[model samples]
Target: MSRDEVLVSTDWAEQNLNTDGVVFAEVDEDTTAYDNGHIPGAVKLDWRNELQDHVRRDFVDRTGFSELLSAKGIGNDDTVILYGGNNNWFAAYAYWYFKLYGHSDVRLLDGGRKKWELDGRELTKEEPSRSATKYVAQEPDRSIRAFRDEVVDAIDNQNLVDVRSPDEFSGKLVAPAHLPQESAQRGGHIPSAINVPWSKAANEDGTFKSDDELRKIYGEAGLDDSKDTIAYCRIGERSSHTWFVLRELLGHSNVKNYDGSWTEYGSLVGVPIENPSEQQEA
Candidate 1:
């Protein structure tokens, strides 16, 4: 899909709220907003419970993913419009997952629910249902995802980016206030990983930056299509947003989201570590 097709504006979404072949889905970190109110005819997708594997610390497998989407009444040919809080953090993560599973026409709700509410758009507690259709799942695409072993190979190549906040990247902040001890045994970043906070890719209104500005941001960070790029945050949600920017917005060919991220890398034994804060005191 074209870059424009990757994001749908509020105006477009409002007009197409009940349009045929379009399904509006709200992806949230939790179920509060959805339980209270949501876009009419929209389904709620919980990022943690539904999308993740029950046993492993990874995404749900192909069979599980297909069943979940099938239950949501989403189909292969339907266009999915996703939105959520935290500046569309989990929404972007869901978008990445949809692409990973080979969903043909997934699009992010530009500005997300926050912007939707700010605009005073109508939200309903009413839930709508469509006939459940079988959603065919595709083989998990590894090109858009980076594993621990892949990250190890990319470390020395300057292809890994820590998209956490400066404090988190520097090991000054272990984790966010809402969730603690979920990161890892350590606070520092992976050795050789560059720090570029994920929020830099968005505007004050939560819309993405312009293509030129986005290219400049990544370009100034020494990233191009020359080698594979791996992006990570604490648990990979924010990095998925960055993944969207690099791949969907910038049109880079070799970008991957390191879903294992800091929680996986920071706690792992025998891995190299770097603490710029520690070095600064020396």
Candidate 2:
């Protein structure tokens, strides 16, 4: 299979649409996008509702996850191909969540829905109905995620990346003006974390850059395979996109997604925070 184990091209996805055991999913920040039009037969995974805990700032519990999968007609052994509208941001987060729960065969749709739509691939409003399945969730993998303490420990020792935009990194904005829900009490990145916006790794069309380009992009920014790397964004969605780029496309080992991200990091009192604008003024 020429397809990278973790990523599939648009051609691959289109060719496999009718393939047995392959389930296509669209994970989006905007719920209506899927209803508007999506890849034919692709089911919807709402980023806020399906993958998150209803009452907590964490992911769904194992039972909740299993139920969500079952409700989505996903068998534990089935192949899942995920894509999204917003440059694959939510799709990559979904990918990270599935990996944490040990879904063995999930793959990201390369370039995601942007590429699919830009290529003028057919979109359908019709929904697919698959038989409901009974899925058993695995124990969550802690190695792929980081909590506040782990991030505090990582300040000096690990490759901590802040994948939010420059404004967010500089404390000029807590979250984008449009997303008041993502705003944090604090607006700066973790102290000593380097700012590398998530979109830098992708082209204008949302496809990832070539491998050599990717190597130069991160390597120049002091990221490499040698150290364990942690990436974070406002609430970890954008950072998960960078996580996908580094861990899957670039083949870096020991990459973890700090899913709690800035939301958790910023709210903590007495934690070291960095504001580039402050440093510049000083």
Candidate 3:
């Protein structure tokens, strides 16, 4: 997929704010940010409550996803434009979810909320009212999703991109600094995985870097574009951003986001782990 196919500029998004057949959704790590003020007519998708399954550790099932979209007044054919804070982290995650359920025309608002705010774009507290539609979602596309078993097997066979902070990658912290340092039984990265912080793919304005720069960024890190790649982070949102960079922007054919990520991988008893911090301590 080309950059234009998956990303729309903030200016373009502003022009399409009221365009029919187009839907804007804000998915932020700080879910409450939407309530404060957001792009006019954009809907709020609470990542924790709406996107994730309530009873299980997995994502919302197809039926649940359909219901959520239906309630959000989104149609199957709507051109979904997703944006959010933190350089589109949760937004890309929601974008990934849209693809997983076969939404054909989903794109990210380049630069997301950060750039919009930086440009002094208009934000509103009033929510738009639209009649809900009965949206149908397709079966989960496992092609872009990596399970624990697949991630384990890919350790040495495929490219494992640990899109986490260096501290987390080195086992100095189990999670990001802002969050509690606990989630997994152990701390470290998957053996043979290379650390590539997801933020590297985006500029200060929150827009993704150019394709050539992206290729060089990963290539210099020893990533083989020809090999199947799996990206992972603590709970998978950050890695989803990297997954978008690799799969959608870079056009890598076989790239998957292991949603379980370190939370699952680090807890597995038999999996091989490389804790540089531990090695240093020893």
- Local distance difference test, per candidate? 0.88, 0.88, 0.94
Give the local distance difference test score of model 3: 0.94
Instruction: Judging by lDDT against the true structure, name the best candidate.
Output: 3
Candidate 2 differs from the real structure by a C-alpha RMSD in angstroms, to one decimal, of 1.8
lDDT by residue (27-89, candidate 1, tens digit) is 997889898999899999999899998798888999999999999999999999999988999
Model 3 — which ten-residue stretch has the worst lDDT? 174-183
For candidate 2, report its TM-score.
Answer: 0.95
**Order of candidate numbers by TM-score, starting with the best:** 3, 1, 2
Best by TM-score: 3
Report the lDDT tens digits of candidate 2 across residue range 157-176: 99999998888889888886
Evaluated at residue 95, the lDDT of candidate 3 is: 95
lDDT of 2: 0.88
Residues forming the 10-long window of minimal summed lDDT in candidate 2? 176-185
Question: Model 3 over residues 102-131: C-alpha lDDT tens digits?
Answer: 999999999999999999999999988978
Per-residue lDDT of 165 in model 2: 83
Least well predicted 10-residue stretch by lDDT in candidate 1: 174-183
